[model samples]
Target chain A: MTDRPENDHWLVRPTTIRLLWWVFCIVLALTVIAQFGFSVKGYFGVDGWIGFGAVFGFFACLVMVLVAKGLGLILKRGERYYDDGDSDV
Target chain B: MSEILSPALILFAAALLIGPARGHWRTAILLIAPLVTLWAVWQVPDGVIGTLSFLEYQIEPLEGSPLRRLFATIFALMAFGGGFYAFRHARWYELATAYAYAAGAIGVSFAGDFITLFVYWELMALFSTVVVWCGGTPAARSAGIRYAIMHLLGGVILMVGIVGVALQTGSVDIQPMLATDFSTWMVLIGILFNAAAPPISSWLADAYPESSPTGSVFISAFTTKAAVFALILIFPGEPVLIGVGLYMVMYGIIYALLENDVRRILAYSIVNQVGFMVCAVGIGTELALNGAAAHAFAHIIYKALLIMSAGVVIIRTGENKCTNLGGLFRTMPLTAVCGIVGALAISGFPLTSGFTTKTMISQAAATEGLVAVYFLLAAASAGVFLHAGIKFPWFVFFQRDSGLRPRDAPWNMAAAMVFFATLCILIGVFPEALYRFLPYPVTYQAYVAGKVIFYLQLLLFSGLAFFLLLPLMRRTRTISLDTDWLWRVVLLRIANAVSTVLLALGTKFATLASGLLGSLRSLSERYFGQLASEESGRRGVFARDWPIGVTALWIAVLLTAYVFIYYI
Candidate 1:
């Protein structure tokens, strides 16, 4: 990995990253609030609850990442695992 | 007997002429054939335009349905884009064969019967193998061979199924059928194999990333989507497909999340995106079918754009792994932006093509009152955002600067990407443009307050999860295992064992035969020819001590004959 210099692009600056986090939180909160402005119609009984999309989306991604990590424990191998003569068809 | 010429024949003509034509003439053929095919795709009305009597069965060679026209139109458009992207740098043979491959896709689009479909399907298998070989490396050669074998296997199964169906039904017309009997089930499995469904999907990841930069863009567009087109026509509402589609969806996401190679990640996502289409086909409602068809049309454009951008990155940086690339947007800004547009479109961001089409599948599940499928699909949407939408751009463009600044994509490549990117946005903004082409009438509204808010929250939260688990998602110099292990490793070991046993069994028989024929072999050798080592006095045919190389040469000749007969 390349080291970040003191004076780099503004987008990657420490202060900017912090500010971006705040903005992300605000926007996320607002999406949940935006649910009240419009009725988030749900075909299922529970999906209609306020902020359900946000909750489901978060946990869904979290589960997927964890599941992938678990799979990697068994399946991941060195990049050249298929490079040897025995592996070649 | 047809009023309009089949557009596929026009592409086939171009494929034939591309090799012999010189510079300007070649350019004209490349640019004009797709335009002519595009025109013919529309000109042929919604019916069988041509037919022929093959072995007493009347077969439709050129047919047009709304679904067929949509697939053919995108295929022609893809040919135009891929040809433009590749014409400047790709080899002449690559261009010729890719056009033939596109012709195969267009032919399948218009195929009205099982025989016509099988013929075009084999054409795709034939030329696409050549395209994969055009990757021009040892890895490419190996992968291409494996790719050829896998597709040949698929082709045989499909041929067997087609023959079985013809015998059973005494008709060969394309129509909807569930996998009830043996023949239809075989047909379903055959098409699913091409769709990159599991137990065999590793071929896409195995061979596609090994292709030449521009070669992959074309390769990525046609084969699987054509399979989806077949599914939409022949297997719509196959309830079995729902379970199969769900498995494909999760499998793509899990595997993509573990991938470190940039191209492999995108290739896995192709499987993911096609999962949505396959599932929608299973839903089999008009709205659901429309979603599947529209998603396929939009998918070809955006997926090609994504691959084109990845191709540019591979060429510019001379890198394929995410671990070796980052901050390329600093120099290759246009390529970066185009890549980001493709990522967003694929993630179904509002105002992108994916959103307009993909949402309908979820809506279909909800409308069907399938509670579990609906929620799983919604979660899969978020997972798609995690793996493809955020993960792709973050690693390739926004991670630590690799400090290797390369020039942006050339004018033609940029033009191709820009063209596809424009189509992505245009389709998203005015989905009615794509909706009119669906096999079923579409009454769905893509943009509304409720839908946008829901998708936004879902996507944004998924983005949050991605960053929080960023360490887990770190790029690694590794590959993850999949079902291909059965053939690549397990089956190879088995073959070696079987060969060893056979060799042991043959030794005794060989000794007896040599003793019997020793005198006659020596006499014939004297009359026919002299051995290279005549002074050694080892002169009998079976008794002679043959050089290892001569025996190897004979084996090679036998294998060559076997391969030739396989194709014939």
Candidate 2:
């Protein structure tokens, strides 16, 4: 905090962001549990499992991010990759 | 009026006026032409309204149907919005070609036969390439070429299919058909190419990001969605589109996730959004078709909004990468808010257009018992939130402060964005109005409690994951390779290698030919050298003054030898 630059927006401050993160985490957990508590119909029966949407979404996104990471290793190139005078398109 | 011109023709006519006109007159035409087209589009009744004799066949140039009108309406509306966005900033030629491009899309929408559709399709290809060239950069020049080549190839394939179908079926009428032959499959492949379907899908990402900011907006809304319209018309429920579309969806997400260029990310997600529409077309249920149409309508608005937002950034700061942008919200608050609205709409957030339109496609899948398809679509939905919905705004406007603040969009551009943003929310809130334009009757409800809760849980968790994974998701000054590598790199490399070898062989052949010529010249010299020397030395047989008696003696000896041989 001592060396931090001036940030007029409270949302971007370290302490405020930390608090928002906690709130977001709690709300997320509650929403997931609410699905089980409400006994909502789901496309698949597994969707009815407690916190299923949460688990699925989180894991799916996690896997997607990881896959993207792995892809970046092979696919990512310098910004000038296309400007190499040959691969213009 | 008894005489009704084609809505597309009206727009095309307007395009011609853009070139010669100047200043306020041009702007007036730019803004009014779409309204005129929209008016014309709605005037006709549901049937073939106009026809022309072409090549001994009666071609329906204008037809009215629920689907055709729906597509035409949206294309016209897109022309209006895109025109509004581009009028002040874009060069006259770009605006002209864009209007013509929109006209082509509108024409395709109303086309009742393959011949008409093919002509309009090529018209769009030609004009949109010109629009890409309006970017006026070396990159834009080359990208336009690649874009043109890919589209021309697709056009050729489609023409072949159309001819084959016409030969066998004896009509060019557009209708839903099975991919049961070489002809139909070729047709499918051709349409898929325009839809940015795989192996060739990279063209969309490769070329679009190179376009001018407003140019990209116009490009995004037309070509791929027109392909969707074509699919709905001719290849609905074709089953294979489901697989092709899912690949587009996932590929879009992964590539966007890895993309550094902000506009390219948006471009990738265009493929992703189009994937939803394509998937619904594959589903082929009444609700699904409605969903596809509705989604296309909705997607045009939101995607244009997003692209416009990115365009504003590009215009304001002259930067297109997330790594080079941040804290834009401070100065460009209006742009940021509109961008977030667009992002939410695209992510299917409740009370947004995307939520209302996209869920219908998923519901269609569930109804059809496409369990695998449904779940994968569900996962891709969250991925959408991850890649575009959140990733776009957070990186460009909210990430680490790049210490750059630029002014917001110009008034006209902002108004254009606001126009679309309002529509995104309005349609989400009152979807029945949009539904009324749908080809199929609307029976699906979007606000069911169970579905709402499920999507909330899913999208929210996806958002949560994005935050937690933000460290890994840092934007860099890099580009992600795509299928374009096949042609842009691999194929080009191969071509280069072949050219180099050919050059080597060419030099070798030239050397050998020259060497052989030299040797032949020397051989001739050998035979003629003595003759020349004899002539010069005055010792040549013909040149020498020999005694008559000596010559006669030699002739007699030669005659004696000949007589002896004859006697023997």
Candidate 3:
């Protein structure tokens, strides 16, 4: 590893990261809250529910990650899983 | 000469020349060949302009249409772009094979008959396997072999379907097909295999990342997208495709989330992105077809750009895994920027080409009152943002520094990337340029305020989720098994066991039979005379062991015949 000081880049500075996270949250909230500003419509009942895009997007990703982790338990193997002669079968 | 020349032949000629040409001559062919093909692509008039006799069938070598031209143009452009990126680094043979592969894609694009189409399809499968082998590793060789098997199997199924249809209908012409019959279903499954649909989807993620850095860039553009072109032409409105496409979209997302290799992550995303197009083809309306074609057009530019950026990293640092890559944005600013652009474009972020094109598919589904499909597609879109949009860039470029400061891309590669990156944004801002080339009338607008806001909310919150769950996505040096385990692991084990049992049985039988025959031969020799001695029989040349490749080939031939007979 390079012996560069830990927080050399401004983007990685702790304060800057923390401030950016706050700004990011505000932008996220505004996207959801801005829905009320517009007349939101949906072809389906569940989609038109308040904050549906936010809720759906969040939970959808969360579910995918969980599903992936669950599947990985069975499917994931060492990088050399198929390399050994015995395992090649 | 015929009034119309096949652009495929131009690329093929270049492929032939690439092997012999050296230095400036090689560079000139690489740059000039695809441009010539591109010009030839535009000059051909629309429809099946001409046909020639192939046995009893009149095979169309070239046909021109808005859609065909669109795919061909991009393929030629990719040949140009990929050539420009690779000429300085990749070996001559890799370039030659990649050009032939591109020819296969262009051939499929303009093929008006099943005969011509199958020829091109097999051409692609053959050449792309060589491209995969260009990785020059044992892993690449194995993966290439497996990839070849899967695609060739797909080709056989497609050919059977085509022959069945021809026998039934008395025509070789390519036309819209439904999966109502056994024949058409085979065709659908065949195309779906290449589209990286379930069960067989693993071949793509299996083979692509195994290829050399530049080879992967070329590998990404064709194959599946050409499958998309086939799906667009042949199986549009096949209802089963909607379910299959949705499954692929979700599968790509989930697997990509668990992936450590940056190129593998991108490979899965190809499935995810193509899923959108496949589903759009299934939707099978004017808007949906246009959406599929336009997205394909935009996708090649951006997707190639994305892999080119990854190739730059692989070329410079020789590390493709997320665990080994980080803080690359420090030195390789251009590559980082281009990668970010591709990631955002792929996620359908507002004002990107994906935004302009992908939304049309969702709009098509919603307009058709496919509420379940619409919602599912939207969720999958969010998932795309998580795994590909955020996960790939964050891990490879912006995570904790791995203390690797690789040099930026070479000028040729950088120029190629800048060229594509400009297109990604330009298409996003002005969808009309792409829309004008669609197969049908283009009336859809991609930039309405409400839709943009909905997508922004959708994609951004997914980003929020990505950061929140970043810990769970920690890269590990492992592989996630897909349905390919059925053959690579399960069936292989069964074959091994069966072969073991058979070998033992054969040995026992040989010993018993030889002993029994020896006694009978002693009796006969006592009575009259033995014709030949057992010692000489055992020492003969015919007693030599058969090669495993020969056994495998015989087995393949038997299985293929069995499938053909059964399907018939």
Candidate 4:
């Protein structure tokens, strides 16, 4: 294994990144809960329920990632897969 | 001598001059060609002009309307900007071919009849193939062939439809069509093929990234947008397009999310952006049509800008995968900045072109009570940000330093990016400049507070999801299979199997046939020899030794015997 580059970027420092994640989580939770107090006409009536966008966005991403991973399992191959002799047909 | 100069002809004619000219003259032609075309476009007043009778049919090669002009103007501007970007870096032939391709698009924009449009449609296919070949790699060559075949198929489908329409209506005039019959359905399928709609959508991602970086930028602007323009003209209000367009939008996002290549992500998003326009065309309201046209215009600029920035990265580092790129912001600050601006613009940040233009499409859906379409478009907006807006910049410029410090883009390329970036913001800030040119009069306002807030909320939350799922989004050295797999793998394997079986059967048949022929030859030779000996013994002399009279007598005797047998 090669040496990792020294972390000179302030934003990517381990502690700072963790802190940023925490702040993001707090903000996301607030936005989700804010749906209860807000009367914004949601695209679906259910969207106005607490944490809808958050739940929808997160689960959608999760499902997409999982589906992609499953697809990758079947479809993924070596970089030279198409360049190989068998594919020349 | 002519009343009006066809803008497409101007570009096409100028394209011929580019190859022969050298040094500064080439640059001058490159700069002036689009300018002249733009000027010619302006000269075309509303209604058909420059009609020429061909084969007893009046073909209007130059028709002017707000929509045609709008599409033509952007195409011309795209050629100029793309030319400027590619002038110094790209080979001369590539630029010439690209100009020819652009001319085809401009021609399609102004074509008043299906015949003229079909001719130019084919022209784009032919020249763009050369541009794809300009990538100068084996991958590019094969991909170019596939690209050509797909387009040829699309052209044939479109031709059949055009012919059917002409035969049905006895007029070849450009007009709206519903998919009420086989003819119109063929036409819709044809246009959708170019638009990179599903079942054939893989062609866009398969081919575009395989082109030379500049070629990809040039390609990003045309073909599909021209298809969008065609849809607006020929197949607007067709309900099926909404489903097709939405499929493309989601397909692009899902594919892009799973993609590892930097330029490829941008390539997928082109389909995504065109999806918005296609969906709006389906909506078929004045507002939706306007939104479609306006969104197409914005999409071209921003998408090209996005691709151009990625081109810079590809040029500088010579690495295209996200796995091989990162931390370019330190040294290639200018490229990073320009790329970020493009990213923001594409993400529909409040003051970006995408926000101004794409929002109109969603709003039209909302107003029409297309609740499902509205929600999905909203979700797609966030997905666009996830897959393209953030994913492109994050992985390429800011992920982790891959320890490659390459120089920023050359001055000319950077200048091109800056010019487009400026336009992205300018159009966003003052959309009226673009709105004035839309096919319909503008009445919708873009910057209401509630809409902005909801959009921000949706996008920001999606951003949060991206970060939360960052671990899952890491780039790898593998490619995701797409619909092309059917042709590339399954169909090819089947062909190979059939050919192998046919070869074996052919060889076996040849051997058996040869054996049977040998036996027949031997049997014939033996029988003939026996017959000759029997006839000679009866005559008691060879033919050479016998007199002519004797030979005649034998022949007559044989004939007499045969006649006797017949009588009996």
Candidate 5:
């Protein structure tokens, strides 16, 4: 097997940086839009709970990610965990 | 009318016989079993068959009503279709076990009493677990164990409630139970568990997807639908189910939105579809109950079609993750088209089975003046389109090409998908056929233009939301977290930790006790003549003659003391 060159690593790749920047911009846009949209809806005599729901949705997503990571630690067996062929057909 | 055989008996006998058979016999048994059962189901008369005495309860095995027969007929039909689909792919044992499982579901549908229902309920649990294990994978084994535990837990609760009802009411007849008794609540919880209600709903997604592709198709048809049938029979007007059902609808939408595996997404949506039925049962109007029944029938067809299409994809490409799949329409056009049909049906698009059946439930809510429920359900309809209708087909079949070319589905799988897709459209266009089979008379129409237009707008906008939110809904290489974490992670960890501590303590206690005995033996050897001989001392107190005699004497002395004290 041939050894990989240093430039072949993903972190230093130009494409990776470009992709990260795109993702960062998207997230920022979503956050801004969600905040403004909730406020505008609330101002127009829509339910004030809309603001609360928006905040709750953001946090819920965050918590879901964190909880999923924690759960993955406990429940993530090897890829082959369920692939053992010892079970009866 | 001609003499009718009992579907339940035929299925049970087939299950018993198929276990020992090899190649051709097994295939023949699998193919013929459902056909026989279907014929038997068709023969059920429109009345109660017979009742037996069980303790203080009367157990009715066969009850023929239009509603019961409707579900029974469809279930028998599903078994035939599913059996044909699996006959070529699944192992003989799997086919046999699945047949037995299908029988249990049909049995529950025809059951006239709680006792008969509970018996078949447990049977479905047992046989479905066997079907899961038939996947012949380690994951399948663990999943089967978890699946069995959850079902047995539900079955025990159901059994306890049945016994309680029998003891208090002195009857086990299956009828509308409106009482708020402990037994009634227990029965509700038991049924809810099977229905994939909150907290424990993860079992359906976790277990069913882990089954073999063919096995998953059969697994999709029963269990929860049986629970829906039970709910309609028992708790028709229970208002609490509305909230529970609403939660499931959103849960399915959100989780499926986040899912990666193709089959897992479908599994989550099953809970979502069943949620609509459960909510209708809560509404408890004739229209709502009819809606629930019609939805169940529609759901079985579309869901099976969806799973069957997914199964074909998995078999063809050996990939199930959407991230790893796309551009399959080019090669597997038939499967893709069938899958899209299923997706539309599931999304309640116009001229589909879901649109015809699911709308009645929402209409029922509106008529009942359940304003909040109606709005939430309407929004949930949008969410359903976002998650299942657009996302599923888009990501799996029409997304950026993954450049993996695979052949179309095999003849059997294609035929199954075609059959179900045809049923979905037929029911959608002519819902009267389905409506006539309801427990009540048909009076509702699903073809109103205003209603159809409203649904189209809501769902179409949801599709817009999906495309607009596409960046956020990108497929990640991760499994979504669900309530199964409680059992699969938390409870499992606790059990492991407790077992470890116990084992450590046990070993330490054993070692220390042996050491103490060794010292005592040495001391005894020095004092008493050769009683603690090397070979004899190592065997410990119970194994030694001196201690044995001493223990016998102590027991004898204690007995004598007890006798004297009592007598005096």
Candidate 6:
């Protein structure tokens, strides 16, 4: 019931957030280059499809991360959740 | 070409020697054992070594085929490297169990018959369980139990297949079996389970990371790679494995991407790496088979190196989660370097073992015009870098410093990692040393400008993708659910629920039946008015004393009838 931001400290780090944004832009730029660079060089002319594949693969990975995070909200146990006895400590 | 016992058997004997030795000497014994075994393996003749007869069947103990020798050589090397790593750090019991496990694997490698293979296969299961137990934690005990059950299940399936094959064909030789018969399917499934194929893949992640830090390094090397060896030997050229391997490859990347535990990520990636080998086995060309073999050898070294580095971090910081760890490169520079080398090798970066080994398999797929598989494998290659190659060392060693400084890994640990790191580069730079030992003759070259440039572009771009998606790929304190959840959670819950309901229903049925029986007894007593009882005044005509007379008369009559019938 607690607000997500209130509980998760990782979301609060401004530096991390900025770094993540920078990384995202860099990856996007590379994908664009990989997709189009071969085409400009006339390397078998599969540039359009290759670009699509790269874009699709990257997004698909993003979706998986999102889905996993959502599922983790429900299924994630306490760090010691499985330790029902005294042995874990 | 000399007469000698198989190196695998000698290794087993050496393991036996270590079992009874004092603790201090046991480490020495463990270290020496593998070197001796390696020497013995080198001495094996280039033909069938020995055969034993059982009933009407012949069981070959040692076969000197190039493929078998190749696998056995690596197994011996792993034992040597693993023994050295474990010798200084592991408990005596763990050392003994590890040797036994190594012996069982090597035994399978040289086994010329299915019977010998199955026997050693089960031994691997049993001893590896002991290694897991040596973690000396309750979590390890439970995980070890589950690990044993999964492997024993695989072993049982294998046993049944072997028996069925023997019954049907009247032979037990461990030769290529490409049939679609029930027995072959059974064998395939059995091997696939150990390969950590889908639906049962969760066992590796669940059990491996739970092992003792040193134990995980040894545990990582043997079972799955041995399965790869068997697959290459028996089910080569089966197309079904292509799909199976692809599934494992993607599963490893996705799950590893989601993983927080450093070792678990590596464990998942092990499945991914083995998947490549398995897929190559499906491709089953000479090139593909060699790729699988070479990859297995290289993978064992680098993967162990990775785990050893992680093991050092865990030992020093007492933390395994990426979220809790970072910036140890400042202190543990050697470990960082070793780990990065391992990551590079695993990611198949140019001039690394993975590049030299894994590319051959992909090249085989391409040559065969399996375009879809080739593409998916290529993407998965990228994903491997995204998840493991970059993610592993990045978060553990480099990312933002958590302001916690840990010392360098121990001399022994560093030595082990350095040795493996050296092997990774040595094999990459001078692949012919490994190529000469392969099952097939060497014609493939890994280093070319086109290939190197393409691979670097692919991997580095993937690295670019991973960092760009850092927000999405951020670590969380969560364990990803895997196919094992079907058995570990759902099936187990169903079984418990059914048992509970069955017990309740049985209690109710018992209570009702007992009550009905009581009522019937009373009803009989009341309705018959105790007439059947001798104490009752109203008895039947044949009851009481008259019954005795009638019985005597009937006995005589029956005797007369019997005599008449017999005579007639």
Model 4 misses residue B264 by how many Å? 1.4
Q: Estimate the TM-score of every prediction.
A: 0.90, 0.93, 0.92, 0.91, 0.81, 0.84
User: In angstroms, how far off is B372's CA in candidate 2?
Assistant: 0.4
Q: Could you tell which candidate, 1 or 3, scores higher by TM-score?
A: 3
Docking quality class, candidate 2: medium
- What's the candidate order when arranged by decreasing DockQ? 1, 3, 2, 4, 6, 5
What is the per-residue lDDT of model 4 for residues B1-568, given as tens digits with 9 covering 90 to 100?
A: 2753568998998899999999999999999999999988888899988777776677887889999999999999999999999999899899999999999999999999889999999999999888999999999999999999999999999999988988898888888989999999888888888999988999999889999999999988999999999999988788998998899888888888888888889989988888889999999999999999999998889888889999988988899999999988877888888888888888887889999999899888988889899878877888888888889999988888788889988999999999999999999899899999999999988886555555666777788778878988877787778888889888999999999999999999999999999888667655543355354433222323668898899999999999999999
The per-model lDDT (C-alpha) reads 0.90, 0.90, 0.90, 0.86, 0.80, 0.82
Each predicted model: what fraction of the native A–B Cα contacts (within 8 Å) does it retain? 0.83, 0.71, 0.71, 0.28, 0.00, 0.12
Residue B261 in candidate 5, Cα distance off native in Å: 0.7
What is candidate 6's CA lDDT for residue B504? 100
Tell me which of candidates 1 and 5 scores higher on DockQ: 1
Residues B1-568, candidate 2, lDDT per residue (tens digit)?
3333568999999999999999999999999999999999998689887777788777888888999998899899999999999999999899999999999999999888999999999999999999888889998999999999999999999999999998888898898997899999999989988999988989998889888998999999999999999999999899988988899999999999999899999999999999988898888999889999999999999999999999999999999988889878888999999999999999998899999999999999999989999999999999999999999999888887777879898999999999999999998899888988899789889987677778888899999899989999987778877788788888888999999999999999999999999998767555444445344542424455779999999999999999999999
Candidate 5 error regions (>4 Å): A1-89, B1-5, B16-32, B532-568
TM-score of chain B of each: 0.90, 0.94, 0.92, 0.94, 0.91, 0.90
Q: Is the docking of candidate 3 incorrect, acceptable, medium or high quality?
A: medium
**Candidate 5 CAPRI level:** incorrect
Per-residue lDDT of A1-89 in model 1, one digit per residue for the tens? 23574477677777888999999999999999999989788888688889999999999999999999998988988787778734311
Q: DockQ for model 2?
A: 0.56
Instruction: Give the per-residue lDDT of model 6 (tens digit) for A4-71.
Output: 54443453356667887687667655645554445322122342344444554455455545655666
- Model 1, B1-568: lDDT tens per residue? 4553568999999999999999999989998999999998988788887778898787998888899999999999999999999998899899999999999999999999999999899899889989999999999999999999988888888888888889998889898999898888889988988898877889998999998998999899999999999999999999988887888889989999999999999999999999999999999899889999899989999999989999999988899899999888878889989998999899999999999999999999999998888998899999999988988888888887788788999999999999999999999999999998888888899998888999999999999999999988887888988899888888888999999999988997898889879966767776554566666554445665779999999999999999999999
Deviation from native of the Cα of residue B285 in model 6, angstroms: 0.9
DockQ of each: 0.60, 0.56, 0.57, 0.35, 0.04, 0.15
Q: Which 10-residue window of candidate 6 chain B scores lowest in summed lDDT?
A: B538-547
Instruction: Provide the lowest-lDDT 10-residue window in model 2 chain A.
Output: A1-10
Give the CA lDDT, 0 to 100, for residue B156 in model 5: 91
